[model samples]
Target: MDQKLTLNGNPITLTGYNINGNNYFMLRDIGRAVGFSVAWNGSTRTVEIDTARPYEEEQPADSVAPTDGSRYVPQVGDTIRCPDGTDYTITDVSRWDKNAFVSGPLGELPQPTCDWSSFPEIELPAAEVRHFQLESGEYLFIRNLYETRRMQYTLQNLAGNHPDTSKDGKLAYGGKGSPAVSIKLSIPSEISAYSFWPWRESEIENLFHSCPPGTYYMEAWDVYKDGVFQRTEYNIRAV
Candidate 1:
């Protein structure tokens, strides 16, 4: 007689001999396949099969496991992103209010009651810049000081090129055999002018590396709590 055997309504492969309409299979194979531990108990002279349980000897009894990265204590100058996708840099820590004062796009402000348990610490990348040589032999450099406090310093105006005030206007290059181009710099919201570099995304030294040898009008816009508070201009020569 041929008969099929199933467990929990699921077919289980069995290699056994049929006797009196009953089938017997290897106990260890079935136990392993079904996520059970099969062990021989010498004193009881019986096989013990139970649900698999991981050993917890390595962990402390009172320990609590974290779902993601390790626990982080907030500190001043540390940047954090809220659940709502707003990024802020901690400016002050107040234990009395149980909140942190942070700098955001709006201005210096205080965040809601801080509970960093669910929030993961993130490191915002450094600022980036792109250069577009204008048709006037001048350079309209675009800088993005992303998520950081910084300043943009204009070096020289040897080319004596005035700002291309035309909306989306094309600028021609002044150098010999140089191609004329038109491009505008999109200033990021997070960037504002400063007299000196701040804690995050400072690229003061990068200026020398990005621009080629040229004379151009350089300026700096200082970002403040309200907005762009000051502008400084200078004559610069890049060689």
Candidate 2:
């Protein structure tokens, strides 16, 4: 049987045999397809396999094709897009360095690292409002912007005040932490991007404990240099 195989976006062919209604593939064919080594030891009368060694064709050296330079090799700081439509920046390329190779036919290779945290900082056209749901079942509002030293935020219930029977008939207020609360944060003189979480997870959970399900308004201002830098608002739903 002829089998069509696609490895790393490249197509190849392999021969397989049907045995007892199951397709069986040769070990040598599988190793060559996956770039591994498979050899038979006549002296020991056993089969030897080496995963560290790459598969080498027995063809003449002249048959090896030269690189056309059309393929792009990723280096440190180079951003590449994955097939899944996600962009990732190369953080390290030490694995490709000649110094990483050992004195052996098959040298150990180091794996490169690509971290999302190491990606370049995002540049926003304006202040952005972000939300995170806490494990305590409360939403934490985050204000992301540039050049921020102080953050002032307010949460207002748009559905007005009401009594929450779930919390001992407590009178739920429209403005949970109103008049507006402000918090001071330290900003380095060299850094500008800032992300501020208005309230702690526990505090947010407590604030909404007695509040009923309704639409709420969240307004936040990024204050720096003794004035407001940017203001953003978001409509939140509570249940």
Candidate 3:
């Protein structure tokens, strides 16, 4: 049989046997749960327990538990075991958001970087950044996307507009009979950027209030299509 156990708010699953209608867990499993050493003495024909040492599993590579009985801190290009007993390879780490995005047998999933207790707060000039902290303890940083004047002029010229006379100053352009070209905005310093979409101030505020506690990244921009106001696009991601 299998048994589920919770120790100090951490959930652990162990194999057990049913004897006389009562569940009996293996000594090794109990040792693992309580952070102690367990071993089998072949010559002595006995089970040995060492309370002074930490628990270490002599299992397969993929299912090995932490030797020191501490939480696993994942990093890029590393394979880690999840709580569901599956292996995942981390591909990227978002330092600003403190999340490690991984792909493996279970597909893509976001895992928190639990080792970090806190991240450096973003501090930028008022002309560029806005920071918020929700009641749920999530940190959010929103910044305006800025482009150099030369880059803006070059984009205007490519879109068939007069670089000197075009007064629209749109970020996104799609002229008639021409392929639509959008400016590739750079992420702000000390922040991470993920998805980009048009969003309003009210909508952003609502999302900030509703999201769960975690670090969040966002980049805001005023996007235009053919000299007309389309929307303010936001690239948002949670760490």
Candidate 4:
């Protein structure tokens, strides 16, 4: 038997007949659809719902063991390996929209522009500019909500990299277009502006490939933390 159900905002439309109007749902399909581990407890005539990751208590120790994504609380010095593979230390953690918001700062800063003659006297508040890193070992430049892949050269750092920010390690375009990430750039050369570029997501195969492969138009706010960045709005792309 099948039935319609909504789980975690996902519409699970099932098809099944109701017997005698007694709609005791079938456990198997529904359980798998909603990512639940289900087993019949024959002794109790009950269906045990794990409601979380399945466990193999009797399984032997092996590298093939399964591990579902676990929401771990991150501390300033806690290092976590995300699914993407880069290592980061959680510098801060906050809750926004009922989800974990994490910030990662590289333990170090981006490479300096190394040139300063065209630099301006950065007149904005210090908080107007911040840096963050993604699980791909790439960094972002942000000020409030506006951020870009490029930052004007400063004695400290230059350019927060974004998805389409560089396909050849250079910005072919700036300040407009679809992007996986966005950052506002400001610097001494009067190059201060807003830039939107894609952030690297999914499998990153070529570090020097300019833009990541398989990155679509989908944009997502992320919770990120690294030794170089801290906790802040890794948020929903505003509508």
Reference-based TM-score of each model: 0.18, 0.23, 0.23, 0.19
Question: Measured by C-alpha RMSD in angstroms, how accurate is candidate 2?
Answer: 23.2
- How high is the lDDT of residue 230 in model 3? 31
- What are the lDDT scores of the predictions, listed in order? 0.31, 0.35, 0.41, 0.34
Q: Per-residue alpha-carbon lDDT of model 4 for 1-239, expressed as tens digits? A: 65667787877876676778766655666676666677654235365778776633322212211122122233445444433332334444443223232233222223543323222233322322223444665443223322211121211122123343333333323345443222222233323222232222211212223333212111112334233333223211211
Q: 36, model 2: CA deviation in Å?
A: 0.9
Clash number for each model: 25, 0, 2, 29
- Per-residue lDDT of model 3, residues 5-115, tens digit only: 888898889998998998888787799789999976523536789999999885533522233222233344443343433233333344312223322222122223221
Lowest summed lDDT window (length 10), candidate 2: 149-158
Highest lDDT against the true fold, candidate? 3
Off by over 4 Å in 3: 59-239
Clashing pairs in 2: none
Clashing pairs in 3: 195-235, 197-234
lDDT, model 2, position 182: 18
RMSD of each: 21.9, 23.2, 20.2, 17.7
Tell me the spans in candidate 4 whose CA falls farther than 4 Å from its real position: 1-3, 42-46, 55-239
